[model samples]
Target: MSPLVIAGASRGVGLELARLARSGGRPVVALVRPGSDSSELRHLGVEVVAGDALSRADADRLFGSLPAGCDAVSTLSGLAGDGRRADDEGNINLVDAAAASGLTGRFLLITSIGCGEMAPYRSERAIAAFGAAVDAKTRAEEHLRGSGLAWTILRPGGLRTAPATGNGILSADPEMHGFINRADVAQLALRALRDPSTRDQAFAVVDRAEARSVNAIDPHPLLALGA
Candidate 1:
């Protein structure tokens, strides 16, 4: 099997994705920041690479080390608090790195809900504080859309670390709101990588039960247009 490069595989959804990829017997190059602890990833039989995804040189080194035709690349990089520019720079670098490496088969990006939209003040504030991050993600999505690659952008709702219930709702529009487990989101991300049906589209993920019960119209067509 081809190696899978997982950026930001230190914890949360990125960690779970690395775990799943390793469990499936795929070689994994787990990317983590310099000086970051990666004992967990190391324990999972992954090759750890210390580099910031925001740096072109680091991204180049990481991807260049991989075989020309690797299986997939998934990014779970995000910034908390007010460092949006840093986050965006990092994500954009990763996207550019992936493109430069010619690894375009399956690109999975984990973004958040309420990204790139103007709603109430509360929502706007929430977005503006991390506006740089959201804007970066939106642009990253746009780049991937035009990159002529098979990609899947997963915009998950409020991420929680609760135990997995093995179910969640997937919406293309942010009109519906809810929360989803980080583990569940990881599962969905891996699914998107392997499932061709999810190609070239952006979808929001929530608890599956909630998705089924929601009254919002499907946003698949709209998402397809962006593809």
Candidate 2:
């Protein structure tokens, strides 16, 4: 098996994914921005590279020297505070690098729900609250879609730090929105990577408890809300 490359493995969902991948006996290489708390990732025996997500130079530096036979890649990076947006630029840089390398196997991106055409399904207030970030991520998703790499985009809703919910499920329906534990999201991502059926598909993932059913979410509301 090839070593899995994880960007933003310093903390949160990225860290959990790295831990899970390592525990499964897969070699793990992590890309962390300089000065982030990567002690846990290092303790997990993950090879860490320091680089900025939005910097093409950093992407070149990291991807150029990536370990041989590197095939799988996952990104859980996003922005905080009010910088116009990093989600689109940062993730696009990675996607571009991966596509240009001609060595990537499966690529998974941990994006949020309500991006792209699904934006209108969210309440106007929710969209307004997170619109900029959502728009940025939508562009990132589009970039990946066109990058010509085998890819899967996992859009999990309202992330929570609670213990594993044990009911995470993937839905093809775009109308659904709810919360999912980070652990469960990582589990699903692992599944997606190994499941050849998931290639090139984008799925809405949520805890079954919260999402209930695909039809539970009404996409019609988005028509009035507008993108």
Q: lDDT by residue for model 1 over 1-227, one digit each (tens)?
A: 77888887888888887887788788898878888899999999999999977668998888788776675555545664455443456666777777788884677777766554412212566666766666667776777677666677887777888776777656766566667888887767766666677877778788855553236546332222113
lDDT at position 149, candidate 2? 85
- The prediction achieving the highest lDDT against the true structure is 2
TM-score of every prediction relative to native: 0.83, 0.89
Residue range 87-182, candidate 2, lDDT tens digits: 788888888887777755888887888877687687888877887788888898999899988888888888999777667877768788888999
**Candidate 2 — which residues are off by over 4 angstroms?**
67-77, 80-84, 212-227
In model 1, what are the clashing residue pairs, if there are any?
A: 168-207, 168-208, 169-207, 169-208
Model 2 RMSD in angstroms: 6.8
Compute the lDDT for candidate 1: 0.70
